[model samples]
Target: MYPPATRAAALALLRRGSSLNATSVALGVSRATLRGWVRNAGAYSPRVAARATCPRDRELDAGAYAHLLGLYLGDGCLSEHRKSVFALRIACDETYATLLDECVESMRAVMPNSVSRNPAPGCVHVTSYSKHWPCLFPQHGPGRKHERPIVLEPWQRESSSAIPSASSAACSTPTAAG
Candidate 1:
Protein backbone atom coordinates (compact mmCIF):
# COMPACT_ATOMS: atom_id res chain seq x y z
CA MET A 1 0.00 0.00 0.00
CA TYR A 2 1.31 3.44 -0.88
CA PRO A 3 1.75 5.91 1.97
CA PRO A 4 -0.66 8.88 1.91
CA ALA A 5 2.09 11.51 1.76
CA THR A 6 3.95 9.92 -1.14
CA ARG A 7 0.65 9.34 -2.91
CA ALA A 8 -0.27 12.99 -2.31
CA ALA A 9 3.01 14.12 -3.86
CA ALA A 10 2.45 11.91 -6.89
CA LEU A 11 -1.08 13.26 -7.23
CA ALA A 12 0.12 16.86 -7.03
CA LEU A 13 2.50 16.22 -9.90
CA LEU A 14 -0.19 14.49 -11.89
CA ARG A 15 -2.62 17.38 -11.31
CA ARG A 16 -0.04 19.80 -12.67
CA GLY A 17 -0.65 18.32 -16.12
CA SER A 18 2.07 15.66 -15.81
CA SER A 19 1.40 12.68 -18.05
CA LEU A 20 0.73 9.40 -16.28
CA ASN A 21 3.14 7.60 -18.61
CA ALA A 22 5.88 10.16 -17.93
CA THR A 23 5.22 10.10 -14.20
CA SER A 24 5.31 6.30 -14.12
CA VAL A 25 8.60 6.23 -16.06
CA ALA A 26 10.18 8.87 -13.82
CA LEU A 27 8.82 7.34 -10.60
CA GLY A 28 9.66 3.76 -11.66
CA VAL A 29 6.02 2.71 -11.21
CA SER A 30 3.52 1.37 -13.73
CA ARG A 31 1.30 3.94 -15.46
CA ALA A 32 -1.81 2.22 -14.20
CA THR A 33 -0.46 2.22 -10.63
CA LEU A 34 0.24 5.95 -10.82
CA ARG A 35 -3.23 6.61 -12.14
CA GLY A 36 -4.74 4.56 -9.35
CA TRP A 37 -2.82 6.53 -6.75
CA VAL A 38 -4.04 9.80 -8.24
CA ARG A 39 -7.61 8.53 -8.24
CA ASN A 40 -7.37 7.55 -4.57
CA ALA A 41 -5.83 10.90 -3.68
CA GLY A 42 -8.71 12.68 -5.35
CA ALA A 43 -11.09 10.60 -3.26
CA TYR A 44 -9.77 12.17 -0.02
CA SER A 45 -8.60 15.61 -1.08
CA PRO A 46 -10.85 18.58 -0.26
CA ARG A 47 -13.94 18.32 -2.47
CA VAL A 48 -13.58 21.92 -3.58
CA ALA A 49 -9.82 22.44 -3.71
CA ALA A 50 -10.16 24.00 -7.14
CA ARG A 51 -13.38 25.92 -6.54
CA ALA A 52 -13.92 29.31 -4.95
CA THR A 53 -15.09 29.72 -1.36
CA CYS A 54 -18.68 28.93 -0.36
CA PRO A 55 -21.29 31.71 -0.36
CA ARG A 56 -22.48 30.71 3.09
CA ASP A 57 -20.12 31.84 5.83
CA ARG A 58 -20.02 30.42 9.37
CA GLU A 59 -17.90 32.90 11.27
CA LEU A 60 -20.81 33.73 13.56
CA ASP A 61 -21.29 30.06 14.39
CA ALA A 62 -17.85 29.86 16.01
CA GLY A 63 -19.17 30.90 19.41
CA ALA A 64 -21.83 28.17 19.43
CA TYR A 65 -19.33 25.47 18.44
CA ALA A 66 -16.78 26.65 20.96
CA HIS A 67 -19.32 26.52 23.77
CA LEU A 68 -20.24 22.91 23.01
CA LEU A 69 -16.61 21.92 22.56
CA GLY A 70 -15.73 23.46 25.88
CA LEU A 71 -18.43 21.46 27.58
CA TYR A 72 -17.15 18.28 25.95
CA LEU A 73 -13.56 18.97 26.95
CA GLY A 74 -14.65 19.57 30.55
CA ASP A 75 -16.05 16.02 30.75
CA GLY A 76 -12.70 14.28 30.27
CA CYS A 77 -9.72 14.10 32.62
CA LEU A 78 -6.86 16.34 31.56
CA SER A 79 -4.15 13.69 31.95
CA GLU A 80 -5.89 11.08 29.81
CA HIS A 81 -4.09 9.83 26.72
CA ARG A 82 -5.44 11.66 23.65
CA LYS A 83 -2.79 10.77 21.14
CA SER A 84 -2.53 8.11 18.43
CA VAL A 85 -4.86 5.11 18.84
CA PHE A 86 -1.91 2.74 18.82
CA ALA A 87 -0.61 4.57 21.88
CA LEU A 88 -4.03 4.75 23.48
CA ARG A 89 -4.88 1.21 22.44
CA ILE A 90 -1.94 0.04 24.56
CA ALA A 91 -3.58 1.64 27.61
CA CYS A 92 -6.63 0.30 29.49
CA ASP A 93 -9.28 -0.94 27.09
CA GLU A 94 -12.23 0.18 29.21
CA THR A 95 -10.90 3.68 29.60
CA TYR A 96 -10.29 3.90 25.87
CA ALA A 97 -13.81 2.73 25.11
CA THR A 98 -15.33 5.29 27.45
CA LEU A 99 -13.25 8.10 26.05
CA LEU A 100 -14.03 6.98 22.49
CA ASP A 101 -17.75 6.99 23.19
CA GLU A 102 -17.63 10.41 24.80
CA CYS A 103 -15.58 11.83 21.95
CA VAL A 104 -17.76 10.31 19.24
CA GLU A 105 -21.01 11.46 20.81
CA SER A 106 -19.67 14.92 21.46
CA MET A 107 -18.48 15.17 17.87
CA ARG A 108 -21.69 13.83 16.39
CA ALA A 109 -23.70 16.37 18.35
CA VAL A 110 -21.53 19.37 17.58
CA MET A 111 -20.45 18.73 13.99
CA PRO A 112 -23.74 18.34 12.15
CA ASN A 113 -24.95 21.68 13.40
CA SER A 114 -21.61 23.46 13.16
CA VAL A 115 -20.46 22.17 9.81
CA SER A 116 -23.07 22.96 7.15
CA ARG A 117 -26.37 22.03 5.59
CA ASN A 118 -27.21 18.54 4.32
CA PRO A 119 -24.32 17.20 2.22
CA ALA A 120 -21.95 20.11 2.50
CA PRO A 121 -21.57 21.82 -0.86
CA GLY A 122 -17.88 22.47 -0.21
CA CYS A 123 -14.90 21.45 1.89
CA VAL A 124 -15.21 21.98 5.65
CA HIS A 125 -12.58 21.83 8.39
CA VAL A 126 -14.72 19.59 10.60
CA THR A 127 -13.86 16.65 8.35
CA SER A 128 -10.22 16.74 9.48
CA TYR A 129 -11.24 16.71 13.15
CA SER A 130 -13.59 13.78 12.44
CA LYS A 131 -10.72 11.73 10.98
CA HIS A 132 -9.11 11.66 14.42
CA TRP A 133 -12.07 9.76 15.86
CA PRO A 134 -14.24 7.28 13.96
CA CYS A 135 -16.01 4.45 15.81
CA LEU A 136 -19.75 4.00 15.27
CA PHE A 137 -19.52 7.76 14.90
CA PRO A 138 -21.21 8.03 11.50
CA GLN A 139 -17.90 8.62 9.71
CA HIS A 140 -19.55 9.87 6.53
CA GLY A 141 -20.09 13.22 8.32
CA PRO A 142 -23.33 15.22 8.57
CA GLY A 143 -26.03 15.30 5.91
CA ARG A 144 -24.76 11.91 4.68
CA LYS A 145 -26.87 9.41 6.55
CA HIS A 146 -26.64 5.74 5.62
CA GLU A 147 -29.51 5.04 3.24
CA ARG A 148 -31.45 2.04 4.55
CA PRO A 149 -34.90 1.60 3.12
CA ILE A 150 -37.74 1.57 5.60
CA VAL A 151 -39.81 -1.60 5.62
CA LEU A 152 -43.39 -0.63 4.89
CA GLU A 153 -46.45 -2.52 6.09
CA PRO A 154 -48.34 -4.30 3.30
CA TRP A 155 -51.58 -2.36 4.04
CA GLN A 156 -49.71 0.95 4.08
CA ARG A 157 -48.11 0.17 0.72
CA GLU A 158 -51.38 -0.90 -0.83
CA SER A 159 -53.20 2.21 0.47
CA SER A 160 -50.53 4.47 -1.06
CA SER A 161 -50.68 2.55 -4.33
CA ALA A 162 -54.42 3.30 -4.62
CA ILE A 163 -53.61 6.98 -5.20
CA PRO A 164 -53.83 8.25 -8.80
CA SER A 165 -50.77 8.88 -10.97
CA ALA A 166 -48.74 12.10 -10.45
CA SER A 167 -50.41 13.89 -13.37
CA SER A 168 -53.89 13.14 -12.04
CA ALA A 169 -52.74 13.94 -8.52
CA ALA A 170 -51.65 17.39 -9.73
CA CYS A 171 -54.92 17.87 -11.58
CA SER A 172 -56.77 17.35 -8.28
CA THR A 173 -55.25 20.60 -6.93
CA PRO A 174 -57.88 22.91 -5.42
CA THR A 175 -57.66 25.52 -8.22
CA ALA A 176 -57.67 22.88 -11.01
CA ALA A 177 -60.67 21.08 -9.42
CA GLY A 178 -62.61 24.36 -9.12
Candidate 2:
Protein backbone atom coordinates (compact mmCIF):
# COMPACT_ATOMS: atom_id res chain seq x y z
CA MET A 1 0.00 0.00 0.00
CA TYR A 2 1.12 3.56 -0.73
CA PRO A 3 1.29 6.21 1.89
CA PRO A 4 -1.15 9.07 1.51
CA ALA A 5 1.53 11.49 0.41
CA THR A 6 2.88 9.11 -2.23
CA ARG A 7 -0.59 8.36 -3.42
CA ALA A 8 -1.42 12.04 -3.70
CA ALA A 9 1.74 12.74 -5.60
CA ALA A 10 1.06 9.84 -7.94
CA LEU A 11 -2.45 11.08 -8.66
CA ALA A 12 -1.23 14.60 -9.23
CA LEU A 13 1.44 13.40 -11.64
CA LEU A 14 -1.10 11.34 -13.49
CA ARG A 15 -3.55 14.23 -13.70
CA ARG A 16 -0.80 16.42 -15.07
CA GLY A 17 -0.54 13.97 -18.01
CA SER A 18 2.42 11.97 -16.82
CA SER A 19 2.54 8.41 -18.00
CA LEU A 20 1.78 5.79 -15.39
CA ASN A 21 5.36 4.68 -15.60
CA ALA A 22 6.44 8.28 -15.22
CA THR A 23 4.26 8.63 -12.21
CA SER A 24 5.75 5.50 -10.73
CA VAL A 25 9.25 6.80 -11.26
CA ALA A 26 8.40 10.24 -9.94
CA LEU A 27 6.81 8.74 -6.87
CA GLY A 28 9.51 6.10 -6.42
CA VAL A 29 6.91 3.40 -6.25
CA SER A 30 6.57 0.12 -8.08
CA ARG A 31 4.47 0.31 -11.23
CA ALA A 32 2.17 -2.41 -10.00
CA THR A 33 1.56 -0.60 -6.75
CA LEU A 34 0.87 2.63 -8.55
CA ARG A 35 -1.50 0.83 -10.87
CA GLY A 36 -3.29 -0.65 -7.88
CA TRP A 37 -3.65 2.81 -6.45
CA VAL A 38 -5.05 4.14 -9.67
CA ARG A 39 -7.53 1.33 -9.84
CA ASN A 40 -8.57 1.32 -6.21
CA ALA A 41 -8.06 4.80 -4.86
CA GLY A 42 -11.20 6.80 -4.35
CA ALA A 43 -9.26 9.87 -3.34
CA TYR A 44 -9.15 11.28 -6.82
CA SER A 45 -12.55 11.95 -8.21
CA PRO A 46 -13.11 11.46 -11.90
CA ARG A 47 -13.47 14.67 -13.82
CA VAL A 48 -15.37 15.43 -16.97
CA ALA A 49 -13.46 14.10 -19.96
CA ALA A 50 -12.06 16.77 -22.20
CA ARG A 51 -11.51 16.58 -25.92
CA ALA A 52 -8.12 18.00 -26.85
CA THR A 53 -8.45 20.03 -29.99
CA CYS A 54 -5.42 20.59 -32.15
CA PRO A 55 -5.16 23.77 -34.19
CA ARG A 56 -6.44 23.66 -37.74
CA ASP A 57 -3.01 23.57 -39.31
CA ARG A 58 -1.42 20.17 -39.53
CA GLU A 59 -0.44 19.22 -36.00
CA LEU A 60 2.34 17.20 -37.58
CA ASP A 61 3.91 17.87 -40.95
CA ALA A 62 2.41 15.25 -43.21
CA GLY A 63 5.37 14.76 -45.52
CA ALA A 64 7.85 14.23 -42.70
CA TYR A 65 5.51 11.94 -40.83
CA ALA A 66 4.75 9.89 -43.90
CA HIS A 67 8.44 9.31 -44.38
CA LEU A 68 8.92 8.17 -40.82
CA LEU A 69 5.85 5.97 -40.97
CA GLY A 70 7.13 4.46 -44.17
CA LEU A 71 10.43 3.59 -42.53
CA TYR A 72 8.70 1.53 -39.86
CA LEU A 73 5.76 0.23 -41.84
CA GLY A 74 7.59 -0.59 -45.06
CA ASP A 75 9.52 -3.71 -44.13
CA GLY A 76 6.40 -5.06 -42.43
CA CYS A 77 8.63 -7.06 -40.10
CA LEU A 78 9.62 -4.57 -37.42
CA SER A 79 10.98 -6.16 -34.27
CA GLU A 80 9.23 -5.30 -31.01
CA HIS A 81 12.19 -3.26 -29.88
CA ARG A 82 12.15 -1.29 -33.14
CA LYS A 83 8.41 -0.67 -32.94
CA SER A 84 8.74 0.64 -29.40
CA VAL A 85 11.60 2.84 -30.49
CA PHE A 86 9.53 4.14 -33.38
CA ALA A 87 6.70 4.97 -31.00
CA LEU A 88 9.13 6.88 -28.83
CA ARG A 89 10.22 8.80 -31.90
CA ILE A 90 6.70 10.21 -32.30
CA ALA A 91 6.40 10.64 -28.55
CA CYS A 92 8.27 13.85 -27.94
CA ASP A 93 11.23 12.77 -30.08
CA GLU A 94 12.64 10.68 -27.22
CA THR A 95 11.90 7.14 -26.27
CA TYR A 96 10.79 6.19 -22.79
CA ALA A 97 13.13 3.29 -22.27
CA THR A 98 11.29 2.30 -19.10
CA LEU A 99 7.90 2.13 -20.78
CA LEU A 100 9.43 0.21 -23.61
CA ASP A 101 10.71 -2.28 -21.10
CA GLU A 102 7.27 -2.68 -19.60
CA CYS A 103 5.69 -3.19 -23.00
CA VAL A 104 8.15 -5.98 -23.66
CA GLU A 105 7.22 -7.60 -20.37
CA SER A 106 3.55 -7.45 -21.25
CA MET A 107 4.24 -9.01 -24.60
CA ARG A 108 6.10 -11.75 -22.80
CA ALA A 109 3.01 -12.41 -20.75
CA VAL A 110 1.04 -13.20 -23.89
CA MET A 111 3.55 -15.33 -25.73
CA PRO A 112 2.13 -17.66 -28.35
CA ASN A 113 2.29 -21.45 -28.12
CA SER A 114 4.69 -22.12 -30.96
CA VAL A 115 7.25 -19.89 -29.30
CA SER A 116 6.91 -22.14 -26.29
CA ARG A 117 9.48 -24.13 -28.21
CA ASN A 118 11.63 -23.56 -25.19
CA PRO A 119 10.58 -25.37 -22.02
CA ALA A 120 12.46 -22.96 -19.79
CA PRO A 121 10.89 -20.79 -17.10
CA GLY A 122 11.89 -17.46 -18.61
CA CYS A 123 11.43 -18.26 -22.29
CA VAL A 124 8.55 -15.85 -22.82
CA HIS A 125 10.78 -12.79 -23.05
CA VAL A 126 12.54 -14.05 -26.15
CA THR A 127 9.28 -14.88 -27.86
CA SER A 128 7.83 -11.45 -27.16
CA TYR A 129 10.91 -9.75 -28.58
CA SER A 130 10.52 -11.57 -31.88
CA LYS A 131 6.73 -11.21 -32.21
CA HIS A 132 5.25 -8.22 -33.94
CA TRP A 133 2.47 -6.48 -32.06
CA PRO A 134 0.59 -5.42 -35.14
CA CYS A 135 -3.02 -4.37 -34.56
CA LEU A 136 -2.62 -4.34 -30.78
CA PHE A 137 -2.86 -0.58 -31.02
CA PRO A 138 -4.80 1.52 -33.46
CA GLN A 139 -2.65 4.50 -32.53
CA HIS A 140 1.11 4.38 -32.93
CA GLY A 141 2.98 5.64 -29.90
CA PRO A 142 2.46 6.84 -26.37
CA GLY A 143 0.82 10.25 -25.80
CA ARG A 144 2.39 13.62 -26.49
CA LYS A 145 5.68 14.76 -25.07
CA HIS A 146 5.65 15.36 -21.31
CA GLU A 147 2.18 13.83 -21.13
CA ARG A 148 0.50 10.46 -21.10
CA PRO A 149 -2.46 9.17 -23.00
CA ILE A 150 -5.70 9.74 -21.15
CA VAL A 151 -7.41 6.64 -19.83
CA LEU A 152 -10.71 6.71 -21.65
CA GLU A 153 -13.71 5.84 -19.59
CA PRO A 154 -15.86 3.08 -21.05
CA TRP A 155 -18.38 5.68 -22.03
CA GLN A 156 -15.81 7.63 -24.03
CA ARG A 157 -15.12 4.75 -26.42
CA GLU A 158 -18.81 4.20 -27.09
CA SER A 159 -19.34 7.92 -27.53
CA SER A 160 -16.34 8.29 -29.81
CA SER A 161 -17.41 5.39 -31.97
CA ALA A 162 -21.03 6.46 -32.28
CA ILE A 163 -19.79 9.20 -34.55
CA PRO A 164 -16.85 8.79 -36.96
CA SER A 165 -15.98 12.28 -35.84
CA ALA A 166 -13.42 14.98 -36.21
CA SER A 167 -11.52 13.77 -33.17
CA SER A 168 -9.92 11.28 -35.51
CA ALA A 169 -8.23 14.20 -37.12
CA ALA A 170 -6.57 15.04 -33.82
CA CYS A 171 -4.27 12.05 -34.17
CA SER A 172 -2.62 13.57 -37.23
CA THR A 173 0.73 13.12 -35.52
CA PRO A 174 2.79 10.28 -36.93
CA THR A 175 2.41 7.07 -34.94
CA ALA A 176 3.83 3.56 -35.15
CA ALA A 177 2.12 1.16 -37.56
CA GLY A 178 2.04 -1.89 -35.29
Candidate 3:
Protein backbone atom coordinates (compact mmCIF):
# COMPACT_ATOMS: atom_id res chain seq x y z
CA MET A 1 0.00 0.00 0.00
CA TYR A 2 1.25 3.47 -0.84
CA PRO A 3 1.63 6.03 1.92
CA PRO A 4 -0.78 8.92 2.42
CA ALA A 5 2.01 11.28 1.40
CA THR A 6 2.11 9.60 -2.04
CA ARG A 7 -1.65 10.01 -2.47
CA ALA A 8 -1.52 13.64 -1.37
CA ALA A 9 1.34 14.29 -3.79
CA ALA A 10 -0.54 12.70 -6.67
CA LEU A 11 -3.67 14.72 -5.87
CA ALA A 12 -1.57 17.86 -5.56
CA LEU A 13 -0.14 17.26 -9.03
CA LEU A 14 -3.61 16.69 -10.39
CA ARG A 15 -4.82 19.90 -8.78
CA ARG A 16 -1.80 21.67 -10.30
CA GLY A 17 -3.07 20.89 -13.83
CA SER A 18 -1.54 17.45 -14.31
CA SER A 19 -3.43 14.93 -16.39
CA LEU A 20 -4.28 11.50 -14.96
CA ASN A 21 -1.94 9.78 -17.42
CA ALA A 22 0.89 12.19 -16.70
CA THR A 23 0.36 12.00 -12.97
CA SER A 24 0.37 8.23 -13.05
CA VAL A 25 3.53 8.13 -15.15
CA ALA A 26 5.33 10.57 -12.87
CA LEU A 27 4.10 9.14 -9.56
CA GLY A 28 4.69 5.48 -10.44
CA VAL A 29 1.00 4.74 -9.80
CA SER A 30 -1.45 3.05 -12.07
CA ARG A 31 -4.13 5.16 -13.74
CA ALA A 32 -6.87 2.97 -12.33
CA THR A 33 -5.59 3.53 -8.81
CA LEU A 34 -5.43 7.24 -9.42
CA ARG A 35 -9.00 7.19 -10.65
CA GLY A 36 -10.06 5.28 -7.58
CA TRP A 37 -8.30 7.80 -5.36
CA VAL A 38 -9.91 10.64 -7.22
CA ARG A 39 -13.31 9.01 -7.16
CA ASN A 40 -13.16 8.42 -3.43
CA ALA A 41 -11.32 11.44 -2.14
CA GLY A 42 -13.48 12.30 0.86
CA ALA A 43 -14.85 8.82 1.60
CA TYR A 44 -14.23 5.38 0.16
CA SER A 45 -17.37 4.00 -1.37
CA PRO A 46 -16.89 0.67 -3.11
CA ARG A 47 -18.20 0.44 -6.62
CA VAL A 48 -20.99 -2.08 -6.74
CA ALA A 49 -21.71 -3.20 -10.27
CA ALA A 50 -25.42 -3.42 -10.93
CA ARG A 51 -27.04 -6.69 -11.98
CA ALA A 52 -27.50 -7.49 -15.66
CA THR A 53 -31.12 -6.77 -16.54
CA CYS A 54 -31.78 -6.56 -20.26
CA PRO A 55 -34.42 -7.68 -22.70
CA ARG A 56 -32.43 -10.82 -23.42
CA ASP A 57 -32.21 -11.75 -19.78
CA ARG A 58 -35.88 -11.32 -18.96
CA GLU A 59 -39.09 -9.66 -20.08
CA LEU A 60 -38.89 -5.87 -19.87
CA ASP A 61 -41.83 -3.93 -18.45
CA ALA A 62 -43.25 -3.07 -21.85
CA GLY A 63 -45.63 -0.35 -20.69
CA ALA A 64 -43.15 1.43 -18.48
CA TYR A 65 -40.31 0.90 -20.90
CA ALA A 66 -42.33 2.32 -23.74
CA HIS A 67 -43.31 5.34 -21.67
CA LEU A 68 -39.71 5.93 -20.62
CA LEU A 69 -38.58 5.55 -24.21
CA GLY A 70 -41.04 8.15 -25.40
CA LEU A 71 -39.89 10.63 -22.74
CA TYR A 72 -36.28 9.79 -23.55
CA LEU A 73 -36.75 10.28 -27.26
CA GLY A 74 -38.30 13.63 -26.55
CA ASP A 75 -35.83 15.37 -24.22
CA GLY A 76 -33.54 12.84 -22.63
CA CYS A 77 -29.82 12.13 -22.86
CA LEU A 78 -27.40 9.50 -21.60
CA SER A 79 -24.06 10.82 -20.40
CA GLU A 80 -21.05 8.61 -19.86
CA HIS A 81 -19.21 8.99 -16.59
CA ARG A 82 -16.08 7.43 -15.16
CA LYS A 83 -15.96 3.60 -14.69
CA SER A 84 -18.33 2.97 -17.59
CA VAL A 85 -21.31 4.28 -15.63
CA PHE A 86 -24.00 6.20 -17.47
CA ALA A 87 -26.43 8.78 -16.13
CA LEU A 88 -29.79 9.05 -17.86
CA ARG A 89 -31.24 12.54 -17.65
CA ILE A 90 -34.72 13.48 -18.81
CA ALA A 91 -35.82 17.09 -18.77
CA CYS A 92 -39.37 17.85 -17.68
CA ASP A 93 -41.07 21.17 -17.09
CA GLU A 94 -40.75 22.25 -13.46
CA THR A 95 -44.38 23.23 -13.39
CA TYR A 96 -45.51 19.70 -14.17
CA ALA A 97 -45.08 17.91 -10.87
CA THR A 98 -46.93 14.86 -12.13
CA LEU A 99 -44.60 14.57 -15.11
CA LEU A 100 -41.54 14.73 -12.87
CA ASP A 101 -43.00 12.02 -10.66
CA GLU A 102 -43.95 9.96 -13.68
CA CYS A 103 -40.47 10.29 -15.06
CA VAL A 104 -38.99 9.04 -11.80
CA GLU A 105 -41.48 6.18 -11.67
CA SER A 106 -40.83 5.10 -15.25
CA MET A 107 -37.11 5.13 -14.71
CA ARG A 108 -37.42 3.03 -11.57
CA ALA A 109 -39.82 0.64 -13.22
CA VAL A 110 -37.43 0.16 -16.12
CA MET A 111 -34.17 -0.14 -14.16
CA PRO A 112 -35.21 -0.18 -10.48
CA ASN A 113 -32.27 2.06 -9.62
CA SER A 114 -31.80 5.28 -7.72
CA VAL A 115 -33.68 8.10 -9.46
CA SER A 116 -33.34 11.76 -8.50
CA ARG A 117 -35.03 14.98 -9.56
CA ASN A 118 -32.76 17.99 -9.97
CA PRO A 119 -34.62 21.24 -10.39
CA ALA A 120 -33.29 23.75 -12.89
CA PRO A 121 -34.43 27.25 -13.78
CA GLY A 122 -37.45 26.31 -15.81
CA CYS A 123 -37.17 22.53 -15.90
CA VAL A 124 -36.35 19.56 -13.76
CA HIS A 125 -33.78 16.94 -14.63
CA VAL A 126 -34.90 13.46 -13.66
CA THR A 127 -31.76 11.42 -13.50
CA SER A 128 -30.87 7.81 -12.84
CA TYR A 129 -27.45 6.14 -12.69
CA SER A 130 -26.92 2.79 -14.28
CA LYS A 131 -24.42 0.96 -16.41
CA HIS A 132 -27.02 -0.65 -18.66
CA TRP A 133 -28.77 2.55 -19.79
CA PRO A 134 -26.83 2.65 -23.08
CA CYS A 135 -27.63 -0.95 -23.78
CA LEU A 136 -31.29 -0.29 -23.15
CA PHE A 137 -31.42 2.98 -25.12
CA PRO A 138 -29.44 2.52 -28.32
CA GLN A 139 -30.28 5.99 -29.64
CA HIS A 140 -27.97 7.74 -27.18
CA GLY A 141 -24.96 9.38 -28.81
CA PRO A 142 -22.79 12.46 -28.76
CA GLY A 143 -24.07 15.92 -29.76
CA ARG A 144 -27.71 16.91 -29.88
CA LYS A 145 -30.20 14.06 -30.17
CA HIS A 146 -31.78 15.62 -33.25
CA GLU A 147 -28.41 15.87 -34.95
CA ARG A 148 -27.90 12.11 -34.71
CA PRO A 149 -29.67 9.46 -36.71
CA ILE A 150 -31.95 7.52 -34.37
CA VAL A 151 -32.25 3.98 -35.62
CA LEU A 152 -33.62 1.60 -33.04
CA GLU A 153 -32.36 -1.90 -32.57
CA PRO A 154 -34.56 -4.85 -33.50
CA TRP A 155 -35.43 -5.39 -29.84
CA GLN A 156 -36.38 -1.75 -29.46
CA ARG A 157 -38.63 -2.01 -32.46
CA GLU A 158 -40.37 -4.98 -30.85
CA SER A 159 -40.68 -3.16 -27.54
CA SER A 160 -42.17 -0.10 -29.19
CA SER A 161 -44.59 -2.21 -31.14
CA ALA A 162 -45.55 -4.03 -27.95
CA ILE A 163 -47.16 -0.87 -26.62
CA PRO A 164 -50.87 -1.57 -26.41
CA SER A 165 -53.01 0.53 -28.71
CA ALA A 166 -56.52 1.80 -27.97
CA SER A 167 -57.95 0.45 -31.20
CA SER A 168 -59.27 -2.63 -29.42
CA ALA A 169 -61.37 -0.51 -27.09
CA ALA A 170 -65.01 -0.71 -28.20
CA CYS A 171 -67.95 0.99 -26.50
CA SER A 172 -71.25 -0.84 -26.58
CA THR A 173 -73.13 2.50 -26.49
CA PRO A 174 -71.96 5.47 -28.51
CA THR A 175 -71.71 8.89 -26.87
CA ALA A 176 -73.41 12.02 -28.26
CA ALA A 177 -70.06 13.22 -29.70
CA GLY A 178 -69.41 9.89 -31.33
lDDT of each: 0.32, 0.35, 0.68
Across 1-178, the per-residue lDDT of candidate 1 in tens digits comes to 6577666666666655456666666667776677566545432323222211111121212332333233222221111124321100101123234433433343444333122112112211121132222221112222312232224345323433454321111011111000
| TM-score on alpha carbons, each prediction | 0.23, 0.25, 0.62
Instruction: Residues 58-165, candidate 3: write the lDDT tens digits.
Output: 567887787788777776778885566788887787776776787788788887677888876567778887767887887877677767778878877788788863
Go through the candidates in order and give the C-alpha RMSD of each one to the true structure: 20.9, 16.5, 12.9
Q: Deviation in angstroms for 47 in model 1?
A: 19
TM-score of 1: 0.23
Report lDDT (Cα) of residue 27, candidate 3. Answer: 91
Pick out the ten consecutive residues of candidate 1 with the lowest summed lDDT: 169-178
lDDT, candidate 3, residue 89?
81
Give the candidates in order of TM-score, highest first: 3, 2, 1
Structure candidate 2, residue pairs in collision: 140-176
Clashing pairs in 1: none
Off by over 4 Å in 3: 1-56, 164-178
